[model samples]
Target: MKANPGSAAGSPTPVVEAKPCGNTGETVTERALRLRVRQQEILAELGVRALRGTPYPELLEYAVQCTAEGLEAEFCKVMEYVPAENRLLLRAGVGWEPHLVGTASVGADLASPAGFALRTGKPVISNHLENEERFRTPELLVEHGIRRAMNVILQGEGRPYGVLEVDSRSPGEFGEQDIAFLQGVANLLGMAIERQRIERDLRAMVEEREVLLREVNHRVKNSLQLVASMLSLQANATDKPDVRHELREAATRINAIGRAHQRLYRSNDVRVIDLAAYLVDLCADLNAAWPEGEVVARTPDEPVPIATDRAIPLALVVNELVTNATKYAYPGRQDGLVEVCLDQAPEESRVVLAVRDAGVGLPPGFAPHASTGLGMRIVTAFAQQLKAELRIRPLDVGTEFSLVISLQAPDRAG
Candidate 1:
């Protein structure tokens, strides 16, 4: 959750007043008790709201940066925890250019608050930046004309999640009270970040499940093809010619159905056909099976993405038409031509698949309702399945069949 709500210009005008508590004659123990009470009130309010109401995604970053900059500090920054790396990374900061805004990370160690917080699961404070001996690089603040800073650890689920830091260009900017208040803000930020990470992981899991289910469907399609092949072998070994012919046609159509899944199953694309690639392979197989005539295939340069429902029927329709072109369209002629072409239709919603043949035109009378041939029925069924318009026209030299169905990107639907 690298959600930096604070603008680059700096946090919005703070509503709270900023002041310094002059060091009086109070004992160190008394002063610490008062500062701890202030921290308690801030944390209690934060906890109440988080438990009672919905929180905005950017609220945590907003509060951290706003509170720090509101304290009239010279430089302020917040670092979010990266659990995978077991480190706190700088996410947002003021008084720095774009280069320094998302700078780097600080692993858990004595010098960095992120490191100390993870070790103790509590906030760490540096009362003075200029006179502190623990810091090896005091020039970091002197170079930027900033002298003081404070660090607060954000705890989520009892683990350190990040740190809230406030710095000033002057030598003595933050006191003990300021440190305590920022620590409360850091605690709120940690809880919000933890919640956001969980939601993100859940969303990724859901998408992964969808992909797995699609893979399972693809596998089922392959199994169906194996079943069809087994029946084909049984038919070939039988003596009855009539049974053999019916079984043979059934096997062919079933294989055509299987081919659709076979292609889709092998691809990572769950819904979309490399219709161009699919047609090329389908035509090659048909050519080998019925090589008496020449069948030429063509497709669009761009890819066409059709969902499962539309893709299955579209592939089978092409299968039946091409199979027929090989069988009957070139009657008594060994040297005819079958050409397949695919192109994006007008309106960009449909793709046109056209199969043309240089052979005798459609048989004398091929009425859909009266035709009993398996090939004609297959074409009609698939056309209806794809919600496509199937047109058969008599050309000057031969016949042409065109199937048009609207195309949609897989992202738009299943």
Candidate 2:
């Protein structure tokens, strides 16, 4: 083998001579064809691993090993370009000392073979590194007595990732065919690196958005609670019984919305609410708000997920029904029982929410649609938004307001 003295830098200058067939019956053409097929198979294997999302470090090591095996070379390495240090770190390699694999560094200037390939986005093959004048042999290669080396730039999105280099200790020449194999490995590695970077960035973005949403929910809860407190103060200062009752009712509705935001701020997932837990908490708050009447809630043991948009409206509907019952259910007596039940309906993808009170039943011939009460109108509008079926059934001694809400498919993006 002879060196090409006039070959330009960062070029795949072939200096290989065809070896004799020896005792085997195979011709030189047949051997070349077989080697080429084997190289293609190696690339296919690497491609499959890359697509499977192999771990970054494991993928790098595998790529270098396969590259060395494909070209039948003694050494191969993946160098990661460190822009700050202006050097290339030996990130992964085979046929190198364990201490040197992650610790060794090489010059990343045009004077070095690997650096020339990375800077020019070209392939470099130094069949005679010691006598090569276009680029200097790196000290690590000189220590290993590497006579021939091939370098290819690892192409990435918008920037070059690094360099892939294969070296040999034996007195053999690296040709154009070897450059093709090395470059193929480098391309696959670069693509995998880019994909990993994109996935990591997406995860970080999602985390940042969730943090901001939680902060917004917390602020909204605080503001709603402040308004409720102000309403309570105004009710206490009022002399008219009717005005006081109206202000207190308004405060209760505002409190219900505030509590929903409180739950969202505390939850890991801000997009959905746990209906069972929310109902129980809401009933507890209602009991505290109305000391004369006891509010009880029965819900499924497991969580029922409802989107935030539907949850707030459904919560308001419950608050209105409970408030109406507490005010009108018991006329003379102060002690009364109100029950709120929430569970999955027997029908598929449906939920049942029923608020009932053991008190004087609804007025005779009363029509919910014809009623001109503000609370009833509010309930009707929100029920329409929920697309729920609202049924009012008068029991022997109480009234039951039943709402059957159909659950939609959960949003996967959330």
lDDT of 1 by residue, 211-244 (tens): 7866876787778778888888988799999798
* Backbone clashes in model 1, listed as residue pairs: 74-168, 108-115, 109-115, 146-169
lDDT (Cα, 0-100) at 327 in candidate 1: 62
* Candidate 2: stretches off by over 4 Å: 1-12, 15-26, 409-414
Q: How many residue pairs in model 2 have overlapping backbones?
A: 0
Tens digits of per-residue lDDT for model 2 on 1-414?
A: 344553435444544447676899889778778878999999999999999999999999999888998887999999999999889999999999989988998988999888988898878888788788888789999999899898899988978889999999977677777787888899899999999889889989998988889999999999999999999999999999999999999998998999899999898899999988889988998898899779999999999988888888999999999998998899888879999999789997789999999999899898777879988888999988888999999898899999999766444585
Give the count of colliding residue pairs in each prediction. Answer: 4, 0
Candidate 1 wrongly placed segments (more than 4 Å)? 1-160, 167-169, 173-203, 210-218, 221-225, 235-244, 332-336, 409-414
- TM agreement with the true structure for every prediction: 0.62, 0.90
For model 2 the local lDDT of residue 64 reads 87
True lDDT of residue 388, candidate 2: 90
Q: Could you tell me which 10 consecutive residues in candidate 2 have the lowest summed lDDT?
A: 1-10
